[model samples]
Target: MFSKIVIACALVALCQAGFLHYHEAPIHYSAPDHFTPSQSYEAPAIHDEPAHEDHYVDEYAYPKYGYSYSVEDPHTGDHKSQHEERDGDVVKGEYSFLQPDGSFRKVTYTADHHSGFNAVVHNSPPVIHNH
Candidate 1:
């Protein structure tokens, strides 16, 4: 009628200045509270750790041991030595070497189970290098 009343007064002044609102202007946030888990809350009981007993020691995993070694050399005038011992069924020892024309030998031995073995050898001569 008059441009339909001027388009209804410009849509009522654009809905009173809210410009026909497409929503975005009502924020009042605070966020720092959220642990919601309640139905009269109740949960704290876990026990089962108290039962230990195990021990067995017999004290004899080889009871005894012995060892010895030696060697001497002045440019091929070789010499040697050995020693031994044991604490079960008895066993004693001695040894020596060097014999390739440069003679030298030694041996002293023993055994147990009622002296079932024995040895005693000694020979030494031929190591004269008056150089």
Candidate 2:
């Protein structure tokens, strides 16, 4: 009686496991007949106009505002760095580095007046910053 009961319990457990592991087939519905196929239409071809060699300027010419960076020495302990701007407003500024995991993590001085900073992390909503 004991052996029979043990075998029955084992069979029940195995059956439960199998049932839990089973996956149902995904049901996919076909598009309606009234739906028009997008590939049936063709885009108009663009014709190349004659190139104006005389109107061409040097491609390597420098612009008015140049991009540059100034790095401060860590001995001075100055956290204030150049501010990043968007549409003439300070979006982010006062950058500092935190070495939590051998990589430099950026710490920005965020203002309540702006939108927010954003950073992407796995399984979590991205970090947002506005100033």
Candidate 3:
């Protein structure tokens, strides 16, 4: 009786596997000769100005959530840009700059996701009057 039951189960399993294989589509294969390889070409040379002592400076205001952080170049009694980020969070920070017109501009960044976010304080420097 046990042998009969085992045979019956095996037959059912075999039927199911056969049905699945019968319904499955055949694999499609393409020969490598059908593909066209791209030709090798040299890229155009890009000219960029050489970096100097004051070429570029960046700063960041990291989050205080026990996450790893780094500040490239913080306020050094001079003008510079800043950026900061926390784990699984969009980068948030502020930038204060002195315009070429001898005025100051303050910009605050709040949760800058790829979509975008609110900018509470966005003020530009007022025109300076040279006496």
Give Cα-based local distance difference scores for all models: 0.84, 0.51, 0.62
**lDDT, residue 18, candidate 3:** 46
Summarize candidate 2's per-residue lDDT along 1-131 as a digit string, tens digits. Answer: 99999999999888888434778999999987797667786789999998867766668643223222446557754422343434233343444342323244454443334555543322223345567
Order of candidate numbers by lDDT, starting with the best = 1, 3, 2
- Judged by whole-model lDDT over C-alpha atoms, candidate 3 comes out at 0.62
Candidate 1, residues 1-131: lDDT per residue as tens digits?
99999999999988888535587889898988889787796678988988887878887666357899988987976778899897787888989888887777889998889977798999978767776
lDDT minimum window of 10 residues, candidate 1: 57-66
Off by over 4 Å in 3: 1-78, 112-116, 124-130
Model 3 error, position 115 (Å): 9.1
Error of 1 at 106 (Å): 2.4
How close to the true structure is residue 58 of candidate 3, measured as C-alpha lDDT? 61
Q: Ten residues in a row with the worst lDDT in model 3?
A: 65-74
- Give the candidate number with the greatest TM-score: 1
Clashes of each: 0, 8, 2
Q: Write the residue-wise lDDT of candidate 3 on 1-131 in tens digits.
A: 99999999999888888433456778999877677878998899999978867555566655454323333344543554545444556656666665556566666666645657756565565676879
Clashes of 1: 0
